[model samples]
Target: MTGALFEVTFYLAAPFWALMIVAPRWRWTTRVIGSPWIALPPLLVYLTLAPGDFAELWTVVSRPDLEALRAFLSSADGAAMIWAHLIAFDLFIGRWMYLDARRRGVPHLALAPVLVLTILLSPIGLLAYLLVRAVTPEARRLHDREREDQPAQ
Candidate 1:
């Protein structure tokens, strides 16, 4: 049952990823991503796994030691809990990236691959997106607002 729920957690998260990656331009995608509750399903998975062995989890987390964490996450339940945790956080990060990109007026074509890379490996994906953001200007209104603040230079 624990293992099954582990798989179900990712399945639940997949659609949000799809919405952000595939149908990113849709009005509904933006509306749907606006809700933080998109994280609820994986949080439920965490709730299920945590109640059963919270003491061990507490130790592993509080110590912040590599060996302790490795030992705890070695178990099926611990692994599932951590997986759920990752799924929830990754989705949240992805959602933020999506909304921020849209608000910044970053092009969809440029962001799609970055979102895919995030799903595969988040650190690299984030680095890539940061590079994109550094080079790409935000919405023109932002630049205009900045100009208003500057005394004629």
Candidate 2:
């Protein structure tokens, strides 16, 4: 039950991920991502897992204690909730990165691998995006504009 939803969570998001990564500039890809509903499936999974154990969920989140938190996450439902949460956030972040990259003229070839890293390990992937973003012409231009606007003695 929960396991199936757990697997389905990622499966549901895969198509959106594929479209954003594979056809970022395509009209349909932009159309699909434009709507906020791309996050609904994973959020639904989180809703399913969360209310099942509200007391534990509340405790795990509201009051931070290591031992209790560890026990809570060790449960199947806890794991599912976290998994769905991760999937939803990762998808949203990937979508943002994709659009931002497109706006900045970052090459699709450069972004494909970074998006994959985001799917697998979001923090590292975000760090990579930040590194790339620093070197992007858009960012450089923005920086130059800001520097020019500064007052000199």
Candidate 3:
């Protein structure tokens, strides 16, 4: 893809991911935004940093004679573009997870070690937090009382 097209794609995708973070009213957005699979676009772009590979992929869709597309993808600028997208998307997802944890009343002390672990090893920290949240008596009680307190409407 040409540099301009790559930039446009990044611009479009970044805002969609950002909306996942900032738009709290839309809960489903969280799932879409937080899924690490969103990393694919930038990863694909990163793979395209080698022009020959980019051309090969493009050839699957259209004419192979688009040498400009190949050159653009091969450039260092393309790699930088991919890097920026990956970093922004990852940070947004991380921030969203942190905020969600805090909103759930995960205590700062309990959350500290998890946060550290998440930074160093994401899956383990996430699983640990899920297990802890699941079994936490206080969390259970709070949820139970909240449900009990709900007014019939």
Top-scoring candidate (TM-score):
2
Misplaced by over 4 Å in model 3 are 51-153
The digit string of per-residue lDDT tens for model 3 on 1-153 reads 546545754554555444433453367665665565665665555555545444544553376455755554465564455454454454444545555555566565665566455544556767876766666666666667878999988
TM-score of each: 0.89, 0.89, 0.38
Looking at model 3, report the run of 10 residues with the lowest lDDT sum. 16-25
If both were scored by lDDT, which would come out higher, candidate 2 or candidate 3? 2
Residue 113 in candidate 3, Cα distance off native in Å: 23
lDDT of 3 at 78: 46
How much does each candidate deviate from the true structure in C-alpha RMSD? 3.1, 2.7, 10.8
Q: Estimate, for each residue in 1-153, the C-alpha lDDT of model 2 and write its tens digit.
A: 999998899998999999988788799999998877898999999998888888998988899999998898899999899999999999888888887787766778878899999999998988898778778787667667878999997
Ranking by TM-score: 2, 1, 3
Local distance difference test values of all predictions, in order? 0.87, 0.88, 0.55
Better lDDT candidate (1, 3):
1
Worst 10 residues of 1 by lDDT: 134-143
Candidate 1 wrong stretches, greater than 4 Å: 139-153
Residue 86 CA error for candidate 3 (Å)?
Answer: 4.2
Candidate 2 RMSD to the real structure: 2.7
Which tens-of-lDDT digit does each residue in 72-142 have in candidate 1? 88999999999999888888888888987887788888889998888778878888887776567674556
lDDT score, candidate 1: 0.87
Model 2 lDDT, residue 86, Cα: 94
In terms of lDDT, which candidate is stronger, 1 or 2?
2
Pairs that clash in candidate 2: none
